[model samples]
Target: MNKIFAKQFNKRALAFGWGMVMAMIIFMSTAWFAFTTTNQKISAEITSLSILEDYYKEQDRLIAYSETSSKLALSQSFYQLAKDSAIDITNSCKVINNVMVWNNNCHPNADFVKQKFLEYYDTNFNSFMLEYPNKMDITYTNVLENTTLISRASPVTFSSEKQGTFAKYNFTYNFEPSIKINLTEQGISLEDFESIYNKILECNKKIECFQKINLENWDISTESQGSWFLFKLKTKKPFIFYENDIENYAPIELNFIIEL
Candidate 1:
């Protein structure tokens, strides 16, 4: 009896030991799976945030580029229009007084030249604006009289030939005639500037791109390169987005007679 009882107790103890070992194996497997799943989740979240960061940076870059490009296009149009008006005034003067005169202006010429230019400014600018509504969007505003400058050629006297030979020939000449016209004013209409600005800002996601185009925001100057007009249009953007700000500028050089 004593031997049978000891064998039975030993069998029960072995079964209990096997059961504990199986339970331990299951617990370890479950713990490892939970750890791996948690790690994967963390990695996925990191990747998603990185992608978002890159997207925002690209958006900001695109916003700046669009603004710069649009302003440049508009500035070139303005330069061409103004330059053409000035050139037309210059083209009207070919003085018939004394062919030997280098700069002749005795035909009552330059006064009418300004008047003709005013007419061209009104007609051509209106036509151009009407044709390219989305490109430049500028209207024919009144020219600033105070800013308009006209430099007319003074009337020249006949330079007669003193060489008293060869049947005493008489001739006339005009050499390299020129006139200077300088016009200074805010060319873009303030009322119409908002629509133009909004068009430029359409590429931005959330960065505040609305800027008021006041005189204080502009620094414009025109330099003459021979007969061409070089316009430098500048503006400062006073918005800050976490230490990223780009200065916008457009430099346009246009020869009056050329299509550029």
Candidate 2:
């Protein structure tokens, strides 16, 4: 009986040791799996943050480019309006003592030009801004005898895809645009000066020219000598008004200086 009891105790001890070894192996495996999962989660979070940063950088660049382009567009629009107003005001002028006088019975002055410019802008250009949904502030200033127009466009925003859902990442741009319009006129070569001169002489020299001569395209000045007069005619230079092309246009001064 004593021998049997000792053998049973030895078997019980061996089985307990094996069970402990198995438990240790399971615990080690569980710990290793948990560590690996935690590492993967950390790596994924880091990669996502990196991607988000890159996306924001790209958005910043895009917004900057857009702002530049918007300024250019606004400047171009202002230039067009100024050119149109100048041409219209200049075209409607009459020549008195070799000087051009506008329809408002005034010579070339900044205040008058500014008044007409504002009138033209209010009448014509407001339609263009209606296409954009954002509010824009446009104002005119004359500081130190300089004609300028300022345009302020509201901030424009762009959102990212799924990545921006939680972080709320977005890009926005605001543009401050202003243009100086000098009330200056450039001289251009007259293509039909000879024809115009001939026509003026033909009309003036005619006897009983009771009919009003069609000098619609020209502004006229006269020098009188004892009931006989010589006609001095000038042509209104045409402006090629285009929105995108600012430089391509006819000059505004001394298109024709012909006397008959």
| Total clashes in model 2, counting residue pairs 3 or more apart in sequence or in different chains | 0
Local accuracy of candidate 2 as per-residue lDDT tens digits, 1-260: 99999999989999999999999999999999899878766765775676667656655654454344333333333344333323334565555444333233422344444555455444333444444344434432322133333333343333343333224333333333333333222222111233443454566644234124445444555544343444444445444334453444542222212222
lDDT of 1 by residue, 1-260 (tens): 99999999899999999989999999999998888777766665565456556545544543344333333333433443333322333455332221111122312233443454445445543443344323422222334244343222223222233232223433333221122223333343222223322332352422122122234444444343343223334433322111123332443222211101
Q: What is the lDDT of residue 224 in candidate 2?
A: 46
How many backbone clashes does every candidate have? 4, 0
State which candidate has the highest lDDT.
2
lDDT of each: 0.37, 0.44
Q: What TM-score against the true fold does each predicted structure earn? A: 0.35, 0.39
Q: Among all windows of ten consecutive residues in candidate 2, which has the lowest summed lDDT?
A: 183-192
Instruction: Name the lDDT of candidate 1.
Output: 0.37
